[model samples]
Every structure is written in C-alpha cells, then in structure tokens.
Target: MPCIGVPCTKSLVRSNKHHLTVSFFQATQKLPSVLLAAYAELDCGGLDLLQGELPQSIANELAATAKAIAAPGKGILAADESTGTIQKRFDSIKLQNDEANRAAYRDLLFSTEGLGQFISGCILFEETLFQKNQDGVLMVDLLKKQGIIPGIKVDKGLETIPRTDDEKATMGLDGLAERCQKYYAAGARFAKWRAVLSIDPSQGKPSDRSIAEVAYGLARYAAICQQNRLVPIVEPEILTDGTHDIATCAQVTEKVLAAVFKQLSDQGVMLEGALLKPNMVTPGSECPTKAKPEEIAFYTIRSLARTVPPALPGITFLSGGQSEEEASANLNAMNKMGPHPWALTFSYGRALQASTLQAWSGNAENKAKAQAALLKRAKANSEAQLGTYAGGAGGGGAAVSLFEKHYVY
Candidate 1:
C-alpha cells in the first residue's frame, strides 16, 4: 500500500514503517490532478479511511468578497509598501518615514473623498493595518467607513533562490494561518501575496525552480487565506526589467500563469474565491520598441484567455512600472476588447500614488490638493476598468517612469 495525492490537512499519520494515511473529506475539498501527479508515489494505505470536515461557508464568504472587490468600474489601491520601501518614497518628497508620518500619509490616502467610488479595496501593510490615524481611528476602520474592503499583504518580500539565475521567491509562509486569523480579526477581509519573477533569457532567468517556487508559494498562500475566511489576491508579477519584446513577455506570462493555475488547482484552492493580480503583457522596460496600449491589451488578454480558468471572477492588472496614464490607457484598451470571462481592473501602487505623493509633499495645507490627485487617478482607472476612460490624468510625476532595476518588494 502507498499514499498518493496532495495533502488536505496539515497533519500526517504514519501507521507503520511503510504505510501512510491522510484523511479525505469530499464535501468541500478538491484535489487537482496535476498536483496529484506532482506528489505521487507516497507509501501509504487506505486513502479515505479517516473522515473530516471543511466548512463550505468559507467558500461562500470568499466568493462574495472576491466579487465585491472586483465590482464593475472599480479597482484596488495598493498602498501596501513596506516600511523600507516607503522610506524611499518619502525621501523623494523630503519627508521622514517615522511611524507617525507613515500613519498620517496613509490617513491622507485612506481619507480621500469618494475613494470607494472607484477603489473597491485597499491593500495595507501590516503596520498600517494595526496603526491608528491622527484622529485615533484604526486605519483599517477608515477603509471600511469609506465602504472599501481592507486587505493585508502577507508576503515578507523576496529572497534570491540559490542555484538560479538571480531569480527570487517570496517568503512568509511560516505561521501564515495564524497571521491570517489575526488579520481577519483586525478587519482585513482579504489578503495579498506577491511573487516576483524576472526575464533575462541570456542569464537563463525565471528558471524552472524559480517558477515552481513562486507558483507553489502563491497557491499555498491562497489556500491558507481562504481557510481563514479571507479572499486572496494571487499576484505573480513578472518584472519588466529586460530587453524582451512584447511577444516574448506574452509567451513567458502564458507559461507562468499556466503553471500558477495548475498549482492552485493542485492545492485545492477555490478559484471562485481568488483574484489574480498580474502584469500586463508589455515590451520590456529597456526594449527599443514601445508597444501601443492596444497591442499590450491584445497580447495581455490573449495570454490570460489561454491559461486562466473561467471560474476566477477577476484579473486585476498590476501597474508595474507603467506611468499613471499608461496604466489607465492599457486597462481601458483591455476593457474595450473584452467580453472576457473575468473582470479586468487594476491594482496599482506607484501609478496610483506617485502624483498624489508629489502633491502632498508632507504638508497638511496640501491635503486637499493631494486628495484631488488621488481622486483623479482613481476616476481615470475606474473608467478604464469600464473602457470609458477619456485619458489625461497625467501631471507632475504621474507620467514619470517608476521602474527600478531588479526591484524588491
């Protein structure tokens, strides 16, 4: 007798020297075929000998939240930059990155007028989730008061995977279930885990190990989030840091997404309860050929259609290094070309915040101006989500390139 297939529970039982046993519950569990093959040949006996139960209500809640986050004419505001990353952003504005300053800055963004009209969700760094604003209100509560769902970024960031071509994988899985529980208790209804990959054919970049590491990590994170009653936004962002053409990017994106979905299935994650936040197909940042928004849209949708399952309710595009207007235009183009299976919106950080940060400049006197900046980008992106964006939200730093070479976090 031998064991075969993905493990459904955290516990493993060794019945004898050569036999293993895993409990099986059919009502709310799904075992993916690819994951089965990947974990095949375990020495076990009596696969379904033990009975267990997983709550179906979790699935219902996750699905509901995912849909709300993907509501039409809305997108996400990715204000989840880590403390160190926020330091760089603050430095650009000649501001300090102290806890109070950070809280105030986020308060500015979260308190913007009518943000929930276009932004359905706001992803928070752990610090922001637990911090109190100037008025002593919890930051998470600010988002909820505005009719927005709050999400927490759970991944610790990226680390280089040894024996690979400088490829990276996201860490932060240890105690993730407990952390998810805490985040849920703190008012976070959703969670995000970003996995980074880079393109460099010359260096054999995005190696097999790198792809598997990120895909598997994202799958496990998603499953854990769902188990804790939090909808997971699955983000596998391929960095725009090479000389590859749009076609090359498309090929890599398709391959990466295929592997990711396969792993998601293998982990028995409910597709209906998850959202995808991926990079749009575009020419590499250093490429000589600049792709039109239409071209980017065409390739992006084509690649997604070839791999992403229809069960997913949303596919939120990450801005990556694209400028604010470019991000909006590309999203607009995608919606113009759709009748696609999933809601194609945005989950932008720099593209959504750069101009606003510039406008604010750490001054309370500039609050109104900064908020206007935020609303403009939000409105632009919201319209883009519906293919009705007329364009031109650019001003100040909105059009500046936000790319950093081999960016971390």
Candidate 2:
C-alpha cells in the first residue's frame, strides 16, 4: 500500500507493523493528513497488531496546562532561580541563603492572600518544589491551595559550546525524561528550560553553531516535557549584555525566534502545548539611549508577530534585567498595542520579587508586608496582561537595574 505524499516503502510498512502499537483508528482519527495517509495504507491486520498509547493524550493534557497557565489576566511567577542565584539575591538583603531562610521566604510568597488572582503558575527551583513550609505542609500544596500551578526549572545551567565565540548551550538533557517524570509526580505540571543567546557583531557572536545548539536543545526539552505531561516553557533568552540598540535587539530576537520555531516544528513539538518565555526587544544593557516602554513594546510585539505562530498559547516575557516597573510597563505597552495572537505576559524573577525581597529581608515580623509586596507586583503584572496597569507599582526599586552580565539560571 502506497501512502499519499508519504513514501511508505515495504520495509517501512513492515517496520511500522513490527513496532507500532497504538490503535490505528484512534490514532488516525485526528492525525495530520500526512500521518493519516501513512496509516491508511496499513493492512487491517497491521492496524490490529498496533498497540499502546499515542502522544495525543499527552498533547491534550499539555495543551490544557499551557492554556491554563497562559490564561488572561494571569502570568507566571518565576521563582525558579537556582540556589547559587538565590544566594546572590539574599546577599543583597544581608540575609542568609540557608535552607530555612529560603523556605520561609517562599512560604511568605506562596501564602500571600489572593495570589492566584494574578499569578496562575510559579516556576520552582527543584528544592522549592519539594520543600515543606515551616508549617510542615508541602510547598507545592501551598501553591495549589492558592490556585497556582506549579512548574519546575529543569535546565542545569549553561556550558560554552566548543568552537564558538563563548556562546553557550543549556545542559541537563542527559536524564531529562526521567527528571521530568519525577517532577510531574511531585506535583509539577510544567517545566522551564532556558537557552541563552548573545549578540556581539564584532566576533559574529551567536554563530550558526550556537543557534542550532540552542534551538535543538530547547526543542528536545519541550518534547521530553510534553511526553511527561508537562507543558514546557521554551525560553530562548537573548542576553541583554551588549551595547546594541533596540533595533538590533529586535533583529536578533526575530532571528533567534525564527530558528527556534523551525527546530520545534522539525522536532514535532505541538506549538499549542508549549509557551514561549522570550526577552522583550530592548536596547542592550550598555546602550546609551534607554527606550521607553512604548518603544520596547513596539519592537517586541512586531518581532514576535513576524516570527511566533498564533498556535502558541502565550509569550511570557522575561525581565532580562529590566526593572520591576520596566517589566510591567513593557508588558502593558505590548498588550495595549491591541490584538496580538498570543498572551503577552510576564515570567519574571527579580522584576516580580525585588521589592518583595527587600520588604521581607528575612524578618518574621515583616511577613505580611512582604506578602503584600508580592501581591502588589503580581497584581501589577496581571493588570499589565490586560493592558490596564497604570504603573508605579514597583515601589522604590521600580527603576533599579537587575542586570547581571552573563546571568545564570
């Protein structure tokens, strides 16, 4: 039997008969025309011989999770900073980065009253995902109680790709499938993997090798997460470490996104089951002229429109060293620009927590104050998601730059 547009060779058909196990009817029902054609060519006996589950169910669950996380008026809280990263944050407040202090701080954030109204999900460091609150309740349970979905950061940081101009690729793929399973069983319904790209024209930075590595790594990570029933937030973050202007950033961002989506498609990732966590187009951190939120929003949305598909559920903008107010304002500007195909929301760590952390400062007496600060930022970003934020919610830290050259995690 010959399949339309599919070269169903006798050897291929024989291999399918020997290895395929999904119910042919069910698998073919909603399959793409290409796959359906191939399946249609199968003998009745071959169809009956096929057994086991297909990715359709997993895809359904992933899509549902992605949609819920990208729901309107809600965004993600990126609390997934690694231990070393959080230590730096704690050092700024003159607080210890011990396990106890970390637990207490996260407890304060997760227990904030009505946090779910704004934050639909939170990306957790592995420790935080399994840590118990001081009250002895599981931390993930606290997030769930507040109606927030729990997600895990699965990447193990970055390593320089050989033969490249110091451009890096995210690691942690060795046991990703097993790790994702563990995370899913631990109550995480989503995962985050960040791929960093940098712009440096002098050396032809972000070489083709670097881009290919990043794209393939992200696509593979997304595939693994979806296989394990986790919606993957594909983050290809273009580092804001250059002296490039906003237009340059936009161009780089569009180029990177185009490569990313191509790899995702080539790897068979369902766009609806994935979310994009990308940097908003902006001037490099060292650039002289700081673009306003409106300008940032313009380039960001235009770049995304040109590269990102509507099938994606959302585009969660990373702070990428933007200030708290800057992040919120940029997000608001994008949404206000009206009708974009995907959700324009935030997945910010410092932008969402800088003020809150300052307010907390590891003081038990300041728990309520800190929680209020968390809620305030969450609310600001939430309103921004709907283009309703009026700004000024970032408090005194609003304009403070959170940039760290070559930031990790």
Candidate 3:
C-alpha cells in the first residue's frame, strides 16, 4: 500500500504492521506540529515512547520532578564522573583512584551535614548509583534520606563527529530507554546527557549539520528518558577553549540552543518536563577579553530569553571550565537581574568539587575540613542562586584549571 500518495517501501509496511499491534493501546491527544516532528526523530530512533500524545499524568509528574531538582536557591551536585575521569581528578591530589577510594570520597560529600540545604539533587556515575559506602548504605538511599534527588548520567561520553575537524557529540543512545528504566528503578528520578559543541569559525567547525545532528540525538534521548520516568537534563554544552569574544560566544550559544529546542519540539518532548544544562555565557578561555559577572549574566540571560521556551521550569548552568568563584558569580549576577521565567541555578562538577578534593586529600582526619570546603562552595552557590551571594569566600580551594579543548563527558 502507498502512504500519503507515495509508494510505501518494504520497511514502511513492516513498521505499519507493527504499529497495528501497538497503536490500539496508545492514548491519543493533539500535539503541536513541533512535537510531531520531534516524535518523528524518536520514532526513527526506535524508542517505544508514546507517539501521538504525552499523557497529562506523565507530563505533570515530569514537571514536578524538574521543579524539585531546581528548587529555590538550590541546584544539583554533579558528581557523575566516570571511573577514569575521577581517577585523573584523584591523581591531582596524589590519592589512589581505586573504586574504594572513589566511594569514600563520594561518601564524604553525601555525608556532610546539611548538604541538602544547598543541593537539591546529585547526578551520579553508574557505579556510584549501585555502590555502597563503608557503612553499607546504598548511595541512592543516602541521597533520598537527605531529601536530595538521585539522577544518573545516561550518556557514555563524547565522540568526534564524523567529517568534522573538531566538533563532537554525546553517544550511548543504543538501549538508552532500558538504561533509564533501570536507573529509575534504582531511585533515580532524573538523568543527564551532555552534547558538546565548539566555536572556531576559522576552522569551520560546529557546522550546521553538526548542530542539527547533535540536537536530534539529544531530543531522542530526552523523549526516551521521559517515557521511562526520568526527567532528562538536556545539555548542549558549548566549549570555551577558543579565542572567541563574548559576542561570538553569545552568537554561538544562541544558535546552538535554538537548534536544540527546535529539535525537542519536533520530537514531542515536553518542555515543562525537562531542565536545561547549558554553559554560562562568557568570553572563551583563549580570549583576551574578560567579561565581568554582570556582563556574562546579561549575555547569558539574553541568549536564553531569545531561544529557550518559557515552559521549561529551570536552567542549571554548567561550569564548563570556569573557576568555582567565576561560575558562582555569574549565577549570582543572573539571579540579580530582572526576573526570568525559568529558575537560574547551577549544575557544577569541578566547580563544586575542586576545593573539597584538595581539602580531603584522601585523609580520614581531614574529612571535616573537606566537608567544610564543600559546604562553603555549596553555600556560596546556593546564595548566588538567590542573588544574595556577596563574595565572602576568596579563591581558597584547589587550583584546578579544568580546561580541555572539546572535553569529553
């Protein structure tokens, strides 16, 4: 049979036959054209999420999860380092990077008294999700006991985009819905997937095709997560290694975000059910121009305003090689500016962990000091999220210059 006046291919007929067995049970609701397009990508990706309609129950539940994760004056603690990545970080402190040491370090972070005061959730590595601390309590239970949501890192890592000089994209979509389901069963209510984009017009990188391809993958991943009951933190991180000025950064960020949202809409992903994990607007690392916190805030908010959907509940800025102080300052400035529709918060990995790592140094006795260091950064960021942070802590943490050209994960 022909479909829509075009001769249906053999693959199309098989897919139609399968749909006959699937569509009878689906609840149908009218969706916008944008969502239909996004669903097209999801369908092509072979995910089994609801196609015609996103159930109101699912949408409402996802909205609540997103809101809770971006709670007022609270943000996420991004401890979702892969085994090897954390090893490199551990090596910096001259500490062993074995699984036990990693567990111990994470335990110290979660065990800190009053950690939930500032952190609303934690994005955990796969191992950390299943691993227990010395006391034999599951890490997810620990986070739950503290009223902190547990989320998993769903993306495997970054891979060089084919035919691109330096642009890259996130992988691990194969069987992602299944991974999200298992993560949800393990007490994770949200998940993160990061897609990296670089700006170097001179190299003709971040080509239009690269942006579209990455955006579609992210949308597909988001759809699958929501179907499996995980609030997807849609991250399209623009790297900061180029010598580009703030204007270039703003331009690139807007373009990338615009593409991302368009794909999400087309994929039928619910905007209210997701959070954005974008790099804060700033001059590139190699740029001579230094933008103040307020300047960065202005550009960041402006870019978001132009591109992001108001339906999204929150935006948790990624540190993206920024110093802990710089990241907090930028977030503070954004909150201080006139009200935005979505919550302005943070989702930092290195920015939140650097000082704590140096202070801990894998010493048992230094645990208190390390926790204090973490609390300090957490408190600073929490206050920043409310626009009340006044620069009390002055660069007292580890000197982690965490900048890589197109970094993976």
* lDDT (tens digit, per residue) of candidate 1 on 257-285: 99999999888887777899999999999
Query: Could you tell me which 10 consecutive residues in candidate 3 have the lowest summed lDDT?
Result: 21-30
Name the runs in model 3 displaced over 4 angstroms.
Answer: 1-52, 398-401
What lDDT does each candidate get?
0.84, 0.83, 0.82
Cα error, residue 116 of model 2, in Å, equals 0.4
Name the regions of candidate 1 deviating beyond 4 angstroms. Answer: 1-54
Per-residue CA lDDT of model 3 for 80-196, tens digit only, reads: 999888878888889888989999999999998999999999999999999999999999988888899999999988777788785677789999988888988889999999888
Q: After TM-score superposition, what is the CA distance of residue 130 in candidate 1 from its true location, in Å?
A: 0.9
**Pairs that collide, model 1:** 2-44, 3-42, 3-44
Between candidates 2 and 3, the TM-score winner: 2
Across 227-273, the per-residue lDDT of candidate 2 in tens digits comes to: 77898999999999989999999888888999999998877787767
Reference-based TM-score of each model: 0.87, 0.87, 0.86
Q: What TM-score does model 1 achieve against the real structure?
A: 0.87
Measured with C-alpha atoms, the lDDT of residue 53 in candidate 3 is: 59
Model 2 reaches what TM-score against the true structure? 0.87
